[model samples]
Target chain A: MTYSTMKPKEVRQLIREKKITTFTSGLCNGYAQANLAILPKELAFDFLLFTQRNPKPCPVLDVTEIGCPEPKLAAPGADIRYDIPKYRIYRYGEMTDEVTDLSTYWRDDLVAFLLGCSFSFEGPMLDAGLEVRHITENHNVPMYITNIPCTPAGVFSGPMVVSMRPMKPKDAIRATQVTSRMPSVHGAPIHIGNPTDIGIKDISKPDFGDPSTIYPGEIPVFWACGVTPQAVAMSVKPEFMITHAPGHMFITDLLNADLSVL
Target chain B: MTYSTMKPKEVRQLIREKKITTFTSGLCNGYAQANLAILPKELAFDFLLFTQRNPKPCPVLDVTEIGCPEPKLAAPGADIRYDIPKYRIYRYGEMTDEVTDLSTYWRDDLVAFLLGCSFSFEGPMLDAGLEVRHITENHNVPMYITNIPCTPAGVFSGPMVVSMRPMKPKDAIRATQVTSRMPSVHGAPIHIGNPTDIGIKDISKPDFGDPSTIYPGEIPVFWACGVTPQAVAMSVKPEFMITHAPGHMFITDLLNADLSVL
Candidate 1:
């Protein structure tokens, strides 16, 4: 069966049964996908405040009740512990384990946050006829740690991480208009051109993900990345943390159109 | 001095000195005003989640760190304890005191939340040549408790409260377009035309605020109100709570234009 055409529930059930262990990109096309960040109840308030303060980089889609594994708002009846294809476990900011399911690690004191992913906006961009170079090239989008510092909340503080896509000047303007409608996802480009202005050292090298080609006359447009919470988590080095592996995400029943504000 | 012409800082300073303790409705004309909700650290997480779930009714503008009295994002350097004109103190859901200063009641475990008020959108509506009945009639906007239940967060659940404005169908459509740009301030009308459909019984009598004149041929339009957090607080009956009294608000340095997403 083609996974991309399946319903979100069917796909989630397959992953729950340990039948799909790969990235969730391109599956359940037109549905919204989310990034996961599970933290203890103690850290939840501070972390939630952080997302609130810096909404562009960390627009929250849904937050599960304390100790509840179900994301009732984004996808009711979907279990956070097993719906995602992959999970990355961290201890004191260092990678501890990679698991397909979190049943062994689930705790009553844990709170899961489902954050908006750039993938939710990429479909809209493609629909707008703008070329997303990373998808066209079949590689990860180039990401950078910029000089722009995020508004700090409690113990969480770090520089903003942005994902870049190279497009012509006209396409860049059109892309801005397209993505601006969806604020629940990273809304609009943070910087359209001149990477050095935001303290990006080199266009060819990125701190995370693979660099895509920038053809002649095409400039790089940057949007806040979902990797931000993980970066902040690493900097703060909480005693324990859990996040979806890069490129792997939780799919929700909500259609991409449902996320548009306009 | 004309209070409407004064800068936000100047107005806030006057409020801090208790020289201006009246309703802040027309003060700082173009700036955004916020409703205040302060809760102890024990209830902060659940309350913040409630705001996140019900953005239409409780659009959060900024949240202070635990034990902090300054709303750094909305108005840096301004102290929350004395800046607002009035505050209502609630103890176990009972009205205890109405005061101009919160210093005596402030606690180290309290967190203050600044929520976007509908006043932020009223300016744009007037600029668009739409009539605002409450302002013209010199009465409080009519507010009703609707059957619409807000999405519950942990330990916090209550019926949604909405403020109503009567307008012709064409003006209602235009008003929708105007407010839709400002999502941070209770974006767009929740319902239009029918009162009983949303569980409102009498159009002339409101549960809170004063009833305004509704001309014949005009339909009643309802927008989610800032009063929701307070209503929820009363329902849940938290041990301690503090909120701005009706009509008196915290004036922020942010212009109303800054609140608009588009």
Candidate 2:
């Protein structure tokens, strides 16, 4: 079946039935895919504060009510527990289990948060004719943990993580203009030229995702990555946490165009 | 002294000295001015959540550390307790006193919050050649309470209050495009025309501020007002609350250009 051609609901239904169990990129072409984070109700306010403080890295798309599996704001009528293709359960900051569904682990005290992902902005960048190197190379975008400290919230604070895409100076400026309209998806590049200035020692060696090729005349541009929140959550070592597996995301019904301000 | 010609610090100093005690609409030229709110530490988290849930009306510029008298992010050297031209003290949801300095009532548990005001975006709108009716008439902009309910958080929930600016259809469109870039300052219009559509019954009569003139070819455009958070705070009726008197803003060191996304 052509998953790319399927509607977001159709894709979610397939995932719910255990028919599709891989990552969720390239599906629902024009729609937004969100990064998921589930935590106990006790930690929900602090985590929400963290996202509010560090908007660039953790732009909140939708937050589910306590114990509710449906993301009523982002994807109404869809069950969050089984909609995502894969979920990683963390116990004391360590990945203890990888699962396709959360029926056994579901708890009434859990709160789910859907955060904006860089994938949403990349669509507009590509539409604007800017080169998204990772898409061109068919690899995950390079991500680095930077020295930029996220504003500390109760038990949730860490250095911001950034995703890099190598582009020419002109393209970088254009990309900035393109993404600036989508503030919910990590608006604009944090750094455009020198990676070392932001504390990224080596351009080629990234802490997460695959490294991208930087051709001649192209410079590395970085944006706050969605992984920072998940990483911070892990660092805090909450007793139980659930997050979408890398590259696997919760597809929202909101179109990419809906997020643009202009 | 010409308030418009003086720098933000100069204006703030004059205000601190108890000399220039009036509305601060055209002061400091290009710099940004903010609305101030101070609440107890216990209510800080809930108030912050309220602002987060309602960014359009309550776009937070900077929040001071608990018990701090200065807004570290917006104006490093200025004292939040006394720098603003005037302040209104609220006790159990009622305005008990209107004072120039909060030093008399200062407490160790207070938290200061500076929210973005529409003045920052009005500069751009005027620069774009769109008519700002209230500014032309030399009166406070007309504001009304709308049927639109703000996203509730904790104990904060109230109808949205919006300020109206009359403009031609073409100008309204341009104004929307212009303000869309300034999200921190109540970005874009929530309603463009027909006040009754948003539960506003009479055009001339407003709940707050002076009436605006809607010329024959012009329409009343509404932008979420910074007054919202304060109104919500009043409704919730915390034991103690402090807010800048209407039109008396807290001047910041940051320029209007700094808040522009593009």
Candidate 3:
């Protein structure tokens, strides 16, 4: 059976059983998929405050109760500890291990946070008739670390990171209007044209992710990247953390349309 | 000088000095006004989580660092303790005192939260040429406690409180479009037409503010009220809590337009 046509619960169950241990992209099409960030209860409040202060870079989808694995609002019955296809363990800023299940690592003081991914907005942008350059080029969306400082909360503090997608000026305007309706996902383009204005030294060499081709007459439109919270959290060097490995996301029951405000 | 034309900083200065101790309705006209809620650090995480879960009713504008008096993002260099016209001190869900400054009651564990008030959207509604019944009649916006329960966070859960404005069916649609762009303030109506559908018993008598006239062709429109957080927080009956008394609010340096997503 095609994964895109399956229910979110079915996909989650498959992942939980370790039968589907690949990246979650294109699975459960039309449903929202979220990035995962799990921290000890000690860092949850500061990390939550960090997301609140830098909302564009870090739009939160749901926050599980302390010590709970279920993301009650985003996906009621799903187990966050096992629902994702892959999990990366980060200890004090360094990635220590890759695991599929976190039963052994789970603690009574852990809090899991589900953050909205840019993937949620891509479908809408495509539906709006705008060609997403990275998708067209079949490469990962280019990401850069900008000099813009995010507002600090407690021990959490760092620079803003943005993902770039090149688009025509007219399409850029239309994309802004389309994504602005979905603030729960990264809302709108933070920068339109000049890359240096926000502190990107080289367009072709992104700090993370593969660089996409920027055609003539098309500008690099940037949106606050979902990588920000993870990057910032790592900068603080907390004792321990768990996150969904790259492209391996937690598929939510919510439709992409549910994130739209209007 | 007319208060409406003055700068937000100037108006806040006057309010801090106790020279203008009344409801801050028309002062700093274009700037955004916020509802205040102060709690000890012990309850800050739960309250913040509550606001996250129930964003429509309790849209957070800014949260102060624990024990800090400045709301750096909302109003830089301004003291939250004395910026508002009046504050109500609640001890275990009971009203104990109303004071202008929090200096006497301030503690190192206190954390102040500034939530978006409905006042931020009224300007856009007026600009859209819709008649706000409460503003036109010189009365407070009617508010009611609904039977719909808010999604609970630890130590915080209660029925949602909503503010009502009577308008024609067409106006309600337009108002939804107008307000949906500003989600930081309560965005869009939760209910329209019938009152009892949301558990509002009486159309004339409201739970909080004064009721406005519902015209022959007008339907009562409801938006999640800012009172939800305060009411929910008070229901938990913390040992100590503080909130702005009624119409008196914390005026922020941010313009009303700043809150708009589109």
Candidate 4:
């Protein structure tokens, strides 16, 4: 069966059945794929406030009620515990387990948060006739830790993490205009020209994800990434937390067009 | 000197000195004007969450630090207590006082929130060659409480309130595209054409502001208004709250162009 041509529900069912336990990239092309972050109820309010304070880094798509596995808004009737291809468990800020399902670790006090991912805007960027360097080479987008401090909310406080994509200056301008319409999906680029200006010491070395090829005329453009929230959550050293493994996103029922302001 | 030609600081100084205690419409052309909401620090977190959950109705421009009278980000060196042309004080949701200065009610525990007003986007709408009906008729935009319930956060919850601008179908489309770029101000029309669909019983009678002129070829286009937050706050009936008097806005030093996502 072709995964890209299948509906979001079908793709989710395959993941739940363990038939598709892999990265969700290139699947469910038109639907939004969101990053998952689950936290205990004790820290839910503060975590929600943190996401609220830092929208660009953590643009929330849907937040499940306490202990509920189903995401009510983003994908009604979809089970959060089993739908994602892979899950990462963190205990006291240390990665303790990686699982395909959360049945063993499921707790009644856990609240699930689905955050907007850069993948949502990449589709539009590609459609706008711009080349996505990372996708073209089939590698992860380069990500760096920035000096920009996210507004502290309760216990959640840290510098922002950003993903970089290289494009020609003219294409960068068009990409900015295309992505600005989707504010829920990281909006516009935060920094357009120089990576060093935002505290990145080297453009070739990234803290997370793989490096991209920068053509002679291309400039590195940086955007607030979903990784920032996960990084912030880990930095807080919470008793327990859950997030999706890199590139293994939660497929939502919402269309990319649904998020467009225009 | 013409108020329009004066800098934001000069206009703020005049308001601070009680020399200009009137509606601030059309004064300080390129700069952004803001809606004011002052609440006790105890309720600041929940109120901020409310705005976060419903950004269309409450696009926050600057939030002052707890007990600080200065809006440090939006207008540096401007006093929140006396810079506005007029102030409205609410006691248990009742409008008990309309004062020019906050000297009598000033408290150390108060927190001020500056929200983006529609005035910020109107300049661009006019520049795009679209007629702002309310401005053309010299009246406030007609507003109505809609049936659409806001995403509740904490204790703050109420129906979404929308301000209407009547325009031809072509102009309405253009207006939407123009305003969508300015998300800090209400981004785009929540509902267009029928007022009854959103629970507006009478188009001629608005809950707040004046009725707009609907020409033969024009349809009512609604944008989420700043009034929604104030109305929601009143519904909560906090022990003490303060807001700007209708038509009297807090002028910010930030340019309207600064809020554009593109």
Top-TM-score candidate index? 3
Please state every model's RMSD to the true fold in angstroms: 1.3, 2.8, 1.0, 3.3
Q: Score the docking of each candidate (DockQ).
A: 0.74, 0.36, 0.78, 0.27
In candidate 4 chain A, what residue range of length 10 has the lowest lDDT sum? A44-53
Off-target runs (Cα >4 Å) in candidate 1 are none
Q: Which candidate wins on lDDT?
A: 3
lDDT of each: 0.91, 0.89, 0.92, 0.88
Q: What are the per-residue Cα lDDT tens digits for candidate 3 across B1-262?
A: 5999999899899998999999898888899999999999999999999999999999999999999999999999999999999999999999999999999999999989999988898899999999999999998889999999999998899999999999999999999999999887888789998999999889899999898988799999999999999989999999999999988999999999999997
Q: Which stretches of candidate 3 lie over 4 Å from their true place?
A: none
Query: Which portions of model 4 show Cα errors greater than 4 Å?
Result: A9-20, A39-54, A64-71, A78-85, A99-112, A148-158, A238-240, B1-3, B13-20, B39-46, B64-70, B76-79, B99-111
User: Per-residue lDDT tens digits of candidate 4, residues B89-133?
Assistant: 999999999999999999998888899898888899999999998
Global local distance difference test of model 2: 0.89
Q: Could you give the TM-score of chain B for each candidate, in order?
A: 0.97, 0.96, 0.97, 0.97
Worst 10 residues of 1 chain A by lDDT: A229-238
For candidate 2, the per-residue lDDT at B45 reads 67
